[model samples]
Target: MRRPVLATLIAAAAASALLAGCGAPAAGDAASAAGTEPGSATTPAVAGEITVLAAASLTEAFTTLGRQFEAAHPGASITFSFGPSSGLATQITEGAPVDVFASASTATMDDVVAAGAAAAPAVFADNVMEIAVPASNPAGVTALADLARPEVKVALCQPAVPCGAGAASVLAAAGLTVTPVTLEADVKATLTKVVLGEVDAGVVYATDVLAAGDTVTGIEIPADVNAATSYPIASLAASKNPHLAKAFVDYVLSGDGASVLTAAGFRRP
Candidate 1:
């Protein structure tokens, strides 16, 4: 990261009419009024299909949850679209057929909430940044500060994405300057660059390294540079089946979803 950061805005593509970009609830009273106890309402399996748009980082975890939800609610078929949080928000706001949305950052979530396309979104988990490098450790990056050295070729996520934004905060705190070969659109892409040795080092989530296991090695970041990123989930206000959407959101907030996300490297929000 440099003294001044460039902000990138991602755009959504044309999807099915049922699919628009994600939007947030109305301000003040409407937001509060929309908030409800998870699973408080009856969540019968009302059917067409339940589509979920989530951040790219949640790909693995949500895929697992989607399977479990399908098994539990046999008639319900689920579809998922994962990418940068900003991109997902754009799709949802554009009227994507998203019944639910799970964002990697609150800022992105706020965009959806403010658009009045979603009910109040509740934060479920938080994630922190880490350095993902090849198992060989050729560059010998030991801490957040080391990326500043001119010899290091780093790859960071785009600022609009959660990991990219966290990297900015950490690098600023470390007083480091990184001339990265590129800034990726999402965290997984950055991690992939490290796994492929396309870059000497890349910033990602601690959980991603854990999931990759032997594929990549993780270097710890200083506690201060560890900015906890919040993940928020909500039922879309444009939902065709808000009742089922609410139930799915409840499942994600329940012990079942937490178990999967935590095991994958997310912390309680």
Candidate 2:
């Protein structure tokens, strides 16, 4: 009887040990169950504020991307300064405390990189010149050649701006020369002239015309005569929040960013 009682106690102890071993998970097993590999480093949550200086032509797309980035990164925020690429590049080179720079042309980006303000900019989009006119079609501008007519009052971005350079290239390709009535500082300002009927037509980006919706009508530039500029984005070297700045640049090169840009009529590079 004593032996049987001892055996029963031993059996009960054995069963309890088995149950404990099967029920409790090991540290590595717990990590696996949570869909993480054991001993692997996890990405830290992005948190901080960044200032982005972008080309005026990228206003609509970049604004939408900025909102999406803020939504995805709850603790992160972005402030944007949109203007001519050349001016924005100058600001970065002049120590404006910018976090990121997205220029409408490679040449403008090169200026920042040359100044050591940025590095290895990625070209994300390309834009072509187009003729933006008021919805009323007051000038009856139908083709690129119409912009050359003596009676047509045209607005253009300043020569230093990407839109102006593109317009110049397009006109040169078509062998048409017509001076602009107004030389605006940025693409948006030039577009405004067309939208407000202050000018019969404005030489701006195709994306600008699309963003204008019904307020302006776009006359397509022939592919052979059209000029396109590549957009490059980079994290500035003097960023106070370097990590956040790089994250923002990465976000702009992401698929989600491409979608917003495409919706805004920017062609993927």
TM-score of each: 0.82, 0.86
TM-score, cand. 1 vs. native: 0.82
Clashes within 3 Å, all models in order: 20, 0
Best candidate (score: lDDT): 2
* lDDT string, candidate 1, 163-256, tens digits: 8999998888877778788999999899899999988899898888888899898998889767778999999988887767887889899999
Candidate models: Cα lDDT each: 0.84, 0.91
**Most TM-score-accurate candidate:** 2
Whole-structure CA lDDT of model 1? 0.84
Give per-residue CA lDDT, model 2, range 1-269, as digits (tens). 35688889999999999999999988789777764577652533477898999999999999999999999989999999999999988888889989999999999899899999999999999888899999999989999999999999999989888998998999999999988899999999999988889999999999999999999999999999999999999998899988888998999999988998999998999
- Candidate 2 vs. true structure, TM-score: 0.86
